[model samples]
Target: MKALILAGGKGTRLWPLSRELMPKQFVRFIDGESLFQKTVKRALLFSRPEELFVVTNRDYRFRVLDDLRELDVEVPTGNVLLEPVGRNTLPAIFWGMKTIQEMFGDSVVAVLPSDHLIDANEDYLTAFKRAERLAKNYLVAFGIKPTRPHTGYGYIKPGEAIEGGYRVEEFREKPDIETAKRYVEANYLWNSGMFALDTELFIDEVKRHAPEVYAAFENASTVGEAYVEVPDVSIDYGLMEKTEEAAVVPLNVYWNDLGSFDAIYDALEKDGNGNAIKVRGKNAYHLGIRSRDNLIMTERLTATVGVEDLIIIDTGDALLIARRGEGQRVREVYRQLKERNDERVLVHRTAYRPWGSYTVLEENDRYKIKRLTVLPGKKLSLQMHYHRSEHWVVVRGTARVAVGDREILLRPGESTFIPAGVRHRLENPGRIVLEVIETQIGEYLGEDDIVRFEDDFGREGDG
Candidate 1:
């Protein structure tokens, strides 16, 4: 058996904390371990490191690698499939299944989404084992028995009883509150988006039900080529709902997709006043005098006087305040910001890179300041800014600086200058992490001002 983890969702509903660059899966919301890491651990319970696979976009490549590194789990780098562009779940899963077929030949593959919160208890293992047993002939989906009337998740109605599972009667869309209540009353399961797929069975189903997607990958030489021709469709619409071989396995385990702030509120521990508070960074605290049944997440001192059933998220850069039931509308704010090309929709104060990370201290029309941290033995791409001249001051450790034709080493309190159009690179030569305060001044200080001549992490064309 093999495992394929999907980690490419944007998580727009969790904005102000989750961004286009750092989605919720990579965010360390529990015990300093990302949801992606937790999902990897769950996959390891059934499959070995070499048999595990991950399908994600190029934007999350380093993040996935860094998370796996921190977990001390060694998954073969080749098993990490990087999609050139996202084409929804169907294409992603098909790509993984095709690869599995080519490598292992008709294996049972567990498909798990990386951002979900699921309890890996005895029930979870048993449910997946049952799904695998049915996967030889059925494209099996693990359906969570509805705990309540949830309007957020799609519902699956089971038909005839089968061994360890049931044949699917219908796949219903997300419903209104009244419809959701009916679904719960009828014993419908919440679509968990987890699956046990036999590569051969899944491939045959794709060919039978979704010939367009099947043909797209059939002729394409590379994943990127296939993505260009593939339509954006989910597995539910493209294959599962249309296939006769669909089956649903009841997974009676604790499962939460954490799709919205309301879900987050439900998952968190509440105080006596029924307020859930999560404070990040140093000296951050929340004081709620008369607040009850509220979720407050902050990075600084916050005081709420008389709020109830509210969601307050403060991330130093942007803050979101909303009613508890209105969590799904947060995606509207993300969509609006995206329409305006707002940077806040894409990144926070700090941004991560393969080499290390950089935090924006301040920025204006003609200048910007950033604190850059480079990991030991890592170097920035050999690049030049056409419009911006940069001044770097070593704040900690040692910096190996290359300017135009000269290379020099700078220690703490030392500084260097690189004029516009002058190619330069920063590196950490010592064992300690290097920290530098960089100031850029020019007519245009956008990130796209870069022109890379060489790169270490295959990011030569990127700005």
Candidate 2:
């Protein structure tokens, strides 16, 4: 079966760590592997590298490529579908199914979300096999047997027993605590958001129940054109709930979407006092006294006293502290920040680019300091800032610099200055990664004050 990994969600509930440019799927949270990487590894269990596909936002193209490179997995580049805009799960799935049909013709495609944490053990393999069997006759959704009353996940009620699974009787929305308890009592399964779909069956179902969506993609010349007309509807809403072909295969495995801080807390290892502490960076550590049942994640030294059932997340640029049960509401903070056009809503102090990454060291109204790390053989765009002048001090490796007509090479401790409106480019010509300290002085230091003359990444506008 071919695999279609969805890596497009923003994961706003995990804000302060998960941002627009770097969503939770791309963030390394477990054992040096991003969730996306783990999902890729999981996909490989059922598919070869050549058969694997990914659907993600256009903004995440480089990140997806980087992750694949890290895994040493060579999926066909064209197989990576970049969505022009998010039109929810149905459109993304349809695009993947259509592509799979066009290439492999009526194959079984496993649809998996990249941000989920799943134990890809024997059970997982067996469950997918079961789902794939069901997919021949039904649009199969792998349903996790509910371990507890979880109000955060949608519930699926299974109907008459089929060959390897049961027909999906009803699809229920996320419920209140009392309703969730009732669901658990009734043996409702948590919607796993994973599917094993027969390309032809899925297409037929969409054509029958969601004709608008089917027409949008079938009639369009490009994915972008189709997206322009497709409504933002999920597969569950647009197809599964309305289709007679829906089937649910029970998947008994350790699965967690990590949708909220509370979920993260539950997934983490805890101390004797029930405190889950995760510290990033060498010098970062957490000390807690009377801090039972608290989830504390930090990048620097953090000490807590007399705290219980609290979620504390510190990512250098922002900190989130909330009561454990209120984790679902964290997205409200993200929405509020977005409403105010706060940069924190979009990125951390360190921002990633196609070329490399840069971390803000200091910034004020008139000046900004950044530590830029450019990978070997990589270069920034050939561009100039209209509002800011830049001073670059090389701290490591060698930098081939271009300041208008003057081309120069800078080694460790060497520096260069580019006046405002003067074109300049920084390239790492050495084998080692290049690190540079950049100081910008100007009246306006917004990232949008740039014009790209040449770019290797096909990027045209603001970074």
Candidate 3:
């Protein structure tokens, strides 16, 4: 069986932690392992590493590689399909299916979203086996038995009982409170967005229904062909709901989408007072006073008094304070920020790089200070900025710097300057992480001012 991981969602509801560049799947919000890593590990339960494929945006290609490298899983480099633009689940899944068919032929394929949390170990394995058996005639969708009257999730009503599953009666969208309560009492299951199907069967069904999307991929001559002809639609809307071959596999797994702060609180380890605290380093501390339920995460000390059912998140760059149950509307904040073209709506203070990472230390109107960490044997792209001049001071290890046309090695206490429009690069050749303090002086200090002439990670324009 081959597995396709959908890892391209922006996850706007999980703002402050999840951004456009760093979505929830890549964030280590739960435990030390990222949700993407956990999803990859889960995929390994039914398939080999060589059979796994990741569908993500072009911007996250390097981040995905870095995360996979952390787990030491070497997926086929070309198998990681990078979309030039996101067209939701329909295009992404169809593209992955086409690629899989071209490479592995018509086989059993499982589609899994990277951002969900599920605990059914043995049950899921058994369900996969059952779904594989049913895939000969139906498109199997794993449906979680609703534990509560959740109005946020879509409901799947079962029709007739089959050998391994049931016929999907209908697909219902997120309903009102009364509707949700009635459905839950009637034994409706929450749509898990998980499916297992025969590749050719799914493709044929998709072509029969959503011919526009199928035709876009079918006419492509190469794997590098852009899926621009496809519309922005979800698999649920484009194919699943319209197909008569849909089957619902009952899954009694402890599943949560964690799409909102309340869902995150529910999935976390709560204290005796019913509170969940997530700390980054040793400096994080939370004190709840007369509070029964809450989530508080901070970089330093946080004291809550007389506040209950709340979410208080304090990152160095931003702060979020919201009522617990009302946390689902946080996407509105993201939308407002985007309308204003705020960078905070997209990236974090600590930006990720292919080689390592860099954090914004301080910034002024004309100057910006940054603390950069370069991993050993890693190098930044050979690039230049037209609008900014940069000064780099090596604080630790050693930096192999390329300034203008000259190449020099700098150790501790040594510094170098690259004038504006001068091509330069930073490299760490030693066995230790190279720490450097970069000071930039420019009229425009945005990240898009760089023009990369060459990059090892295939990033020629942006780092």
CA lDDT, every prediction?
0.94, 0.93, 0.90
Writing each residue's lDDT as its tens digit, candidate 3 over 103-133 gives: 9999889999999988857888988889989
- Which pairs, if any, clash in model 2? none
Q: What is the RMSD, in Å, between candidate 3 and the native fold over all Cα?
A: 1.4
Candidate 3 has its poorest 10 consecutive residues by lDDT at 221-230
Model 2, 51-145: lDDT tens digits are: 89999999899999999998999989789999999999999999999998898888999999999999988989998988888898999999999
Best-to-worst lDDT order: 1, 2, 3
- Tell me the number of clashing residue pairs for each predicted model: 0, 0, 0
lDDT, residue 5, candidate 2: 97
In candidate 2 the C-alpha lDDT for residue 92 amounts to: 94
State in Å the error of residue 236, model 1.
Answer: 0.5
Candidate 1 vs candidate 2: the lDDT winner is 1
The C-alpha stretches of model 2 lying farther than 4 A from their native spots are: 461-463
RMSD of each: 1.1, 1.0, 1.4
My TM-score estimates for the predictions, one after another, are: 0.98, 0.98, 0.97
| Model 2, position 296: C-alpha lDDT score | 90
The 10-residue segment of model 2 with minimum total lDDT is 454-463
TM-score of 3: 0.97
- How many clashes show up in model 2? 0
Indicate the residue-level lDDT of 158 in model 1: 97
